[model samples]
Target: MELRHLRYFVAVAEECHFGRAAARLHVTQSTLSTQVKALEREVGGPVFVRTSRRVELTEAGELLLVEARRTLAQADRALDVARQSVRGETGVVRIGFSGIAVLAGTLAADLHHFHRAHPRVELHVTELPPAAQVQGLRDGTLDIGYSPDNGLGDVGDLVVGRGVRTTLSIAVRHDHSLASAASVAPADLEGENLVVYAADEDDDSVLDRLGAEQRARVHRVTGTLGALVLASAGVGVAVVPAATERVGLPDIVYRPLRDMEADVEVVTLSRPDELGGPVRAFVRSWDRAGRLTQS
Candidate 1:
């Protein structure tokens, strides 16, 4: 009926001796007998048949013993899962990411580090534009985000951590005349249609910065990889973070943007007061990655 009753019944069924069962359970034989008798009455049947030489399980006792072991095992597993969850060893963490911030910044490295450190933590990573990241964080959908400072930095009531700055680079088709050049000046991009990240609702944009000194019209792509692919197909020149070259996609050349120096900062954003243990652990993992980089 109860857990203790099942436990007592299991011990006695295993030992097959009243005295030994009581000793194993750290209880008196009389007490064990009374509990077992109570259990038997509740079940409306005899759980054990006793003879002078030895004790044996009746048909009801045998069936109950098998089910009882399974129930106890399940109960123990449930307790363990609860304890682990409380300790932040296992849970889900929802992370939102902007194109360059996640793929071209340290966010990608930090993700690998976090997964290695907390293998049991489930990571729900979403690739979103800076505006979406802000919205997701503002609502309860996203616990944390790796985003550029342009849109997410000045958002309401969110905690933003200082992040590394990334220099801009020009991505162009491999066969383009200037692709082999050491670096590209903003003048070179003048009159050239440029593929750029989808602009956030905020006015401050990396594309705007890169094209500030030029007359290029911006054609937007939703993600970092998409921007590069469009550039590779000669759709337009793309100004991307230098870190994007780490992927080494073919048919595109990433060259430093010279003459005009524009830098975008990638930062971590989280709910001001709603960050949970799993989310904190994820942030801590990024901190550790930063330390290792500095070291």
Candidate 2:
């Protein structure tokens, strides 16, 4: 039977009097009686037995009332959950990151804040290489990413969120000559053995910037920590975001790169037109964190 039929049955069952049930349901007594009869016919059984003095439920009526109440309650709960998801209060957001030193902690902090505010929402984080983050975002495996801007190009369908610039710094062994300098210029790295992030096919600018002479001295490392470890062991110096110092390697000293500029950008496959409340909240938190760090 339809929902209205179930509701009419419930009301009549609860009130026990056709006239009173109709009044409670804002319907006439005859209308209520006819609807209840229709419902009984649809169910293939009588729902109530009537006497001149009172009305009482049959066994079938009792069972239908119990089940009808449960069904209505479940339907209401499902609607509430769907609404929450639409409001961005409950659902899953898959976030990808690369280069732990630059965006990992900031992303973690924003996630903690978002979780506190919307505990029903699930945040899934993955650490991937810069190239992998881009691929994941494009392929719908990741909803958002945090990575250096160099990795993300003008992918027609993707949206890039507000980005913040963080200075590139030189990571050198504490005993290295350049480690003693207040700041090292690009020219200072002329003949120095340099450790760098492994190039992806999309990274032509980085490759081009380090021309033949610089490329000759370059040693590619698999990850941020590997570059730091190599620098610490005196295998070579590395150029990393200033944030890298936060990872805390005692044997490695970080010196600002006097002329280089690098930025860590937040990327998303989600459309600008479709950004939900949670995504907006996260972007705000990220912006605040960048301001705090800058100040």
Alpha-carbon shift of residue 176 in model 2 (angstroms): 3.6
Model 2 root-mean-square deviation: 4.3
Give, for candidate 1, the lowest lDDT window spanning 10 residues. 286-295
Encode model 1's per-residue lDDT on 178-281: one tens digit a residue.
79899998878877888766545334376557655443366766578888888988988987877777767788888998877677777777775554767777
Superposed by TM-score, candidate 2 places the C-alpha of residue 145 at a distance from the truth, in angstroms, of: 1.8
Best by lDDT: 1
Alpha carbon lDDT at 12, candidate 1: 90
Q: After superposition, which runs of candidate 1 have C-alpha atoms over 4 Å from their true positions? A: 17-20, 27-34, 50-55, 88-95, 99-108, 120-126, 137-144, 153-163, 174-182, 185-191, 199-203, 207-216, 247-251, 259-261, 270-280, 287-295
Candidate 1 scores a C-alpha RMSD against the true structure in Å of 4.4
TM-score per candidate, chains pooled:
0.75, 0.80
lDDT of each: 0.78, 0.71
lDDT of 2 by residue, 150-241 (tens): 54456556555545456567799999999899998777888888887652633544434434265767776546788899999998888766
